[model samples]
Every structure is written in C-alpha cells, then in structure tokens.
Target: MKVKHITIIGLGLIGGSLGLALKKQCGEALKVTGVDHDQETLELAVQRGAVDYSTNDWKRGVEQADIIFLCTPVLQIIPIVEQILPYVKVGGILTDVGSTKGFLAEKLLYMMPSGVHYVSGHPMTGIERSGIMAADRGLFKDKWYILIPEASTSPEAVEIISQTLTWTGARITTMDLYDHDQCAAIISHIPHVVAAALVNLLGKYPALEESFKLVGGGFRDTTRIASSNADMWADICLTNSQPITQSLLQLKELLDEMIQAVEKADRPAIHHFFKRAKVRRDILIEETDSHVV
Candidate 1:
C-alpha cells in the first residue's frame, strides 16, 4: 500500500532525517508532517526542507497520517504510543526509531488497538550531534535498519513498513525482539557505557589530569560518543538495563582474565589474546569494506 502521508513525532535528528529522506525519494507523492514540543525545532525542520508541515499539536500532525514514526526517546516512546493510539487512523501503520526493542514489544503488544499495526524498528545510524540542525538526509543510507515485528503482526504491515524504509536507502533486517536487544546491548549500549566509563576513569585520578591533556586521536575517538545527551542515554540505559548489565559483566570477565595474564607475566597467553582480537578486528574491517561498494 502506498503511504500518502507520514507524521514524525519528536522532530529531532532521527525524525527530521526521516522526513528529509522521504521527501527526497517520494517527492510530491508523500507528505511529511513534523511534530515537536519545541517551536524552534519545528520551524527549523520546515526551513531545512526536512518536513512539509510543522506543528506543535501532535493530534493535527498524526490525524491524517498513513504512518507515524514515534521517534522519541525510549522512555517517552511508550507514553506517546498510548496517547496516539486513539488518534491513529484505522489501517494506519506505526513504527519507532528507538534503540531498544524488547521493552517496546512487551508494552505495545496488548496496548495496540485493532486495525492499527505496530512494527518496532531501530535504524543503526546516528552521530554524536543531535537535534533538527544536525539532521542529515543520508543518515540511513547503506546503514542497517532492524525491524522487530510480533507473531501477531500482519505480513502486509511488515511489507508496508519495509517498503517505506527502503525509500531512505536503508538495508532492512528483520529479527526477533529478544535477539535484537541482545545484539544491540553488545554492539551499541555496552560500548556507550564503556566509553563513558573510560572518560570517568580519567576524572577519578586528578594526579594524571595534567598528563591527560596530551591525549591524542585514540582517546578522542574512543570517547566521542561519551558526549551524547545525558537524558537520552540515561533512559536507554534504564530501559535496556538487563542486557546491558549482562554485556558489561561479560566484558568484566574478559578484562579479569587479561589482567591476571598480564600480572603473571604470561607472555604466551597475552600474545594469544592479542592475536585473537586482531583476527576478529581484521575480519570486521574486511566485512565492512566488502559492503562499502
């Protein structure tokens, strides 16, 4: 089914980018409406051509939408979903760009009214900078977009949602909700936590603070995402606490092994650990390179 209009809530980086990408691909065929509490963001989205319509009133934005992308924070996504359930058109599709999927699936499965379809999605793409000003039309290009649909979800709903995402140049991958959260925990959530932890470690030692001034590319690159919005990260960490904690514990176990090996002067074990990591890193680089073209 053709999507005539899409209403994007939040009007932040993800929401604004979706609107821009849709307008670029569908041209006049699709109408994009941007909804946000911030009047400045709504106006910026319109001025930047990311959206055709801007409104602080979500009811007006979503009333006629064929699809609604609830691009709010993870904690806010559920509440917004509840609020908009009554307003969504019958047969209309609703999706999200949240990082965590398990919480959403659990909360929305029974709350979703009949006639409206819900498909949880996470676009594996973003930058440290956020908000409408940082929105980029190419944000999702060639990036992975994971969709988690329940067993009750209609095939037609998944197809329509998949078709809509294709317009943004994303590579769509559908997976079970639990598996999605586990993978995200390892690849995204734990990494952010580690980044922040690394930064915090520096704060703990004021004696080395002066020496830290000489930190180079490695330090900057590793902690680049540590500067992300605190509120957003806090909500994500809370929502996906279980998986994130598991991943962190696994990391701790590995670190303990490495520390013991180094303390024992076990050259062979240290070499083997480094070799294993190098092999995996090389394979990852090779795989990423193969996908570039």
Candidate 2:
C-alpha cells in the first residue's frame, strides 16, 4: 500500500495530466511510468515530463508498479486489465478514471487477481479536448474525484489510492457503484448527450450556413462538450445505458411539455417554465461557485 511506483495505462488527457500532477507534487518519491499503444504518445509523455519512463509494453510497464491507473476508454478498461493481470505486482492497487462504474465494478470485482485490489474511480474533470497534447497539470485541481470500491477491495488499498490522488489537488469522495452511475448519468452523461444532440440539431437545419453566421457565445458554450471524443462518449452511453435511458426519457418528457405549451401558445406556461429553469440554474451556479477553492 506504500505506493512508490505508479503505472498509468492510456496516456490521453486524464492519464497524462495525472502523471504530470503526480510528478509535480510527489517529485522523486514516486516513479511514474506512462503507457500507451502509440509510441509517439509515449515519447510525447516523456518529453512533457509526465512520467519518469514511457513504454508500449504492458507487462514491463506494470510489473514494478505499486499502483496501476487504467485511464483508457470505458470499453477498453476491462480488456486491458485482463491483459495486464498476470504481470501486475502482488498486493498492487488497480484503479481507473472511467466515467461509468456499474459494469466496471461488477467485472473487475470478479476478474481481480487474488492479491491485487481493484478500486474504481472517476475524475469529474477534463475539457472537451482529448489526447496527451491537451493534458494540463492543473486539470484536476479543485475538481471532484469519485471512488467506487468493491466489497472485495481492501480498506488499505482504498486509503492508499485516495492518498495518492490527493497529490493531484482533486477533492476525493466515495459513492456506491450504482449510485455513482446513476448520478453520473444525470450530471455528466446526459449533458454530453444533450450537447451533441443540440449540435446535431443545428446540423440538420436547411439554412445551416446562414444560421452558423449568427452563432454566438450561447450556442458555443452549450455545445462545447459536443466536440469531445466521440468514441469515449459512445462507450459511456453503451455501458451506462439503463440510467442514461431513464434520464433521457425524463428529458424527453420535459421537452414534450415545452413543445405542447409553445404549440398551444400558452404564454403563462412558457413563462413559468423559463422562470423555474432560471431560478433553479441560478441557485445551482451560486451553490457551485461557493464551493470552489
């Protein structure tokens, strides 16, 4: 549990930023290794000082690791863990930055090697940008990092991973796997889906070219997340389908209510809807801003 050697698989934004933060905060106390399938990414990670070493060999990367971070896309996490299981050091802690956790927790709990511990984690941070080039050392600062540990996960392992993640300046919190997924579906998953849908709606307009000419801060801000990595979002949607589907249905109901009110020219209903949203959004922003460090 004394984490000295850390191996991060998938040197994308989250993984690379984690490496940079760890190296910055922990200095030489931790030996960080960056792993990616792409040799160019590994070189970039090394050049950026994100890790002490970089490699494409999974076995070599994880063999000496005291803690392994799986920062890959949701779909790839399990497969990568399966491949690295044999090489992972005994008593090492395995964690992840995957957005959805229900499926991951279930599978990882069953697949974890006898000696190794699997602790599921999801950092509620990151920009719309992807890749190591977009990695920022301060990305996780003041952001929420949710940990969902399985019953089989040892308390010592949870404490070790939590302590290590603190070096990145993230606010650590724990949640039940099911609760985490459900909450994520509402706050993270649904927002991404809606953002993409808004962009796609604009794309389908007949006067798209003319409409784009009038594009302002509102549209850009609302749809910024639509520019995020498509493959990763797709994987999230697939893995957290149940919660996401239910949330989407609720969203649809709200939208239908708005559509009916507008169709019927019900001015009072429209005004009330916008008023309620404004009040709720204002309170949400106020409360959130109050918590920022």
lDDT scores for all predictions?
0.89, 0.93
The whole-model C-alpha lDDT of candidate 1 against the native structure comes to 0.89
Q: How do the predictions measure up, each by TM-score?
A: 0.97, 0.97
- Model 2 regions more than 4 Å off: none
Best-fitting candidate, measured by lDDT?
A: 2
Worst 10 residues of 1 by lDDT: 103-112
Q: lDDT of model 2 at residue 190?
A: 98
Q: At residue 289, give the lDDT of candidate 1.
A: 70
Return the number of clashes found in candidate 1: 0
Candidate 1 to truth, TM: 0.97
**Residue-wise C-alpha lDDT for candidate 1, range 1-293, written one tens digit per residue:** 77899999998889989988999998888999998989899899999999999998768988999899989888998888877787888989888888988888777877878898888899999888889998999999999999898888878988999999999999998989899999999989998999999999998999988899999999999999998878788989998889999999999999998999999999999999999999999999899778864
Q: After aligning candidate 1 to the native by TM-score, how far in Å is the CA of 6 from where it should be?
A: 0.4
